[model samples]
Target: MWADKSYTEVTFKGCRPTEPASNFDKSVDIQLYTAGFGDKVGPLKHFTKCFELSTSTATWTGLPKGLYYFKIVKIGGESHELKKIDVDQVRVDTTLAD
Candidate 1:
């Protein structure tokens, strides 16, 4: 999601894959970064921060306004997989307040 103005917080709704069975017992990491940075040479070079969600919904605060992107990673060792978020099941909301 792109934020035209700085926001104190962003709300991320819980999401499930189209094929829930594929998730199994894996836990995924929700990572945030600047736009066009998530796929750079070094994945962590443009890293911002990581979020841990205890519930279906999560709110991350104190982020600067700008173009941004998210990376969903399935937790595992060296073989961890990068998962794509199901846009249909997920909702990202940022304050429209100016």
Candidate 2:
């Protein structure tokens, strides 16, 4: 999903297969970085911060306005490209109030 100014938070959802009759336990690691920086090196190396979610759904908040690269890491250390978004810039109404 794209991060835009209208939303204050970002949510990611995914599913994983678990061993039958065993406890369903797993986590996902989310990383964010400046646009283009993420691809030059490892996601973890250039990440701004890391977020872990035990369930399939994850929500990140308090993100600043800018272009960011997103990635998701599975429990086994596999990384998946998520998306790049330029947080929608807020347009201010400069005209004098009518």
Candidate number of the best TM-score: 1
Q: Write the per-residue lDDT of candidate 1 for residues 12-89, one digit (tens) a residue.
A: 434333346345333444555667555311132111222223223344455655676655544321123544333324
lDDT of 2 by residue, 1-98 (tens): 24333222233323342333133223345554546444321233222212232212223344444455545543333433332212122122212221
Whole-model lDDT values for every prediction: 0.42, 0.34
Say which candidate scores most in lDDT.
1
User: C-alpha displacement of 46 in model 1, angstroms?
Assistant: 20
User: Pairs clashing in candidate 1?
Assistant: none
Pairs clashing within candidate 2: none
Please give each candidate's TM-score.
0.48, 0.36
Q: In lDDT terms, how accurate is model 2?
A: 0.34
What are the RMSDs of all candidates, in order? 6.9, 11.1
